[model samples]
Target: MNQAFRDLFGAKVAGAVASAKALGQVDHSGLKGALREVLVRSLLRPFLPPSIGVGHGIVISAYDDQSTEQDIVIFNRASLPCILIDEESGLFPLESTLFTIEVKSRLNATELEKTHEKAARLEKLRHTPGETTPEHVIPCLFAFETDLVQKTDLHRYQELIGTSDPSIREICVVGQGRWFWTPQGWHHTPPTDTYSEVAGLIDGISSVYERVQATRSRPLLLNYVD
Candidate 1:
């Protein structure tokens, strides 16, 4: 890394450690903003480089009808901005983008259920009437913070992802732990881990960063207006 990058990274680490400590007693709701700052400033920005760099990005804006849930959103310049809806909020808007991400601290039965539900809903919206189908191909990503186990809670999810359409892109599971991913129709299982280990996970599967460059769209409320 260059001197400037090293310096910036050092600063980011310091800020993140401090934020992590300060938010120890706070809830996710209270620390959303600070946590977002940490993810972009510390995790994503520092690791990815310009050549592999996706593109300009932005945080999803709150629509007048719905409450906020997500932390940050990245998109590709040529395509629409990617949307990430909060699992609890169920408030993802219809928009064209290369991909959509569902971030989580860990993966389990409940998490898979929620993800499946959200994916189903988004699929429905894509083919609905009057809804301007996103011009760009859409994909789904799950950023999990745990190692995956086979033939368990994540089995069905794994099956679904493996069988999903090409436009869906490959699913991502990020965490401190590691696991194997055998693409559906394939037999060999490849080892994988967090972005720290798998740098290409984002762009390899879906390049929403491209969409962010072309448009600066934000998530809007379709049904869950509150």
Candidate 2:
């Protein structure tokens, strides 16, 4: 079962990467980026439980602060339906959001720093008062390629990790390796195979979903009322 799961997503990941590269020859970077995001959304939807909705959107707090457009916003559709701004985008309430992901065609130090900053801003968005939800939204960074040297770049990665919000859960660069956070500290898992990197990410998402399921109760949406 595990191998089948890995094989399925691994092929999807390869296909997405191939399609993105084919599109990269075009002059428009935005088109390529958007295609990558769409491909990633397709890969995730089939694997996630039906109750967990996925889309591209901006997450808004009750106070009206909003996250920048997220590449992938995973939320509890069964509990609270997000407002659809359009076919490809929507407005997800902070309390309804499980997590947000920023996808990149390439991962570099500058891009990683920017993602960290974005995650920090997301950490500031307060949920509806007294709502039964995760205290912080998990922020994840996913990239198809990376520019950092595996050995010499360790310090740079560590420095960013040292200062990032604790809610920033995972950074995955497919074909490279992944960095994940735990109560003990950050840990690195070198890529063991083409499929393992993405498989690790799916596993991480499942873990978060399971944890939320164990702790989450019916959210008190009434708390949003004045």
Candidate 3:
């Protein structure tokens, strides 16, 4: 069953990659980035549960603080409705967010630093009128390709994370490898095969969804006070 699942998922990822490469023919960076995001969203939709929603949006805290436009925001649609800002984006409450993803066409040192900065901002967002804030809204980074050498570049990646609280919990450089956070520290796992990378990505997301659902002790709306 697992092998069958991996085979099916790999085919979809391959198609997405081909579409992304085709999009690269366009000279406009903004257009290429937007289309790449669309490709990822479409890739994730069929795999995720219907109760979970996937969209491009900004995450907003109860205090009105907002996260920079996210490439993709995964949220609990079964319990909360995002404020639609447009056809392509919405304003998601921090409490409703399961996670946010930042997609890059190519992973480089500069891009990694930028993703870390965004994750830091996401970690700083606050929820109020409650004893505990939701702990499930993690930040993740994904890239179609990476310019950095995996072994030699590990230090540079670690330096970007520094000694701060980790907000970006999972990262996948498709076909290359992935990095995931644990209580001890960040760990890297090279793909066993091309398809395993996509499997790892999906597994990380599924784990986050389960953790989020497990931690939901009350109505999300109760976190906000007028």
TM per model? Answer: 0.46, 0.86, 0.88
Per-residue lDDT of 213 in model 1: 28
Candidates arranged by TM-score, highest first:
3, 2, 1
lDDT of 2 by residue, 50-162 (tens): 88888888888767788877888988886656789786588887767887888888777897778777887888887554535555678888887777765523455567677
What lDDT tens digits, residue by residue, belong to model 1 across residues 1-226?
Answer: 3767556645654454455446544667446434533454345544444432222222222322221233333333232223433322222333333345454444565656565555454444332233333343243444433445554323555665665643233344443322223345412223332133233453344344454323434333442244
Per TM-score, the best of the predicted structures is 3
* Tens-digit per-residue lDDT, 9-63, candidate 3: 7788888877877777789999998999998888788778888889898998777
Best by lDDT: 3
In model 3, which regions exceed 4 Å deviation?
1-4, 129-133, 150-154, 216-225
lDDT of 1 at 33: 39
Give the runs in model 2 whose Cα sits over 4 Å from its true position. Answer: 1-6, 131-133, 150-155, 161-167, 213-226
Q: Which portions of model 1 show Cα errors greater than 4 Å?
A: 1-26, 29-72, 77-96, 126-137, 147-154, 159-169, 175-197, 205-226
**TM-score: model 3 vs. ground truth:** 0.88
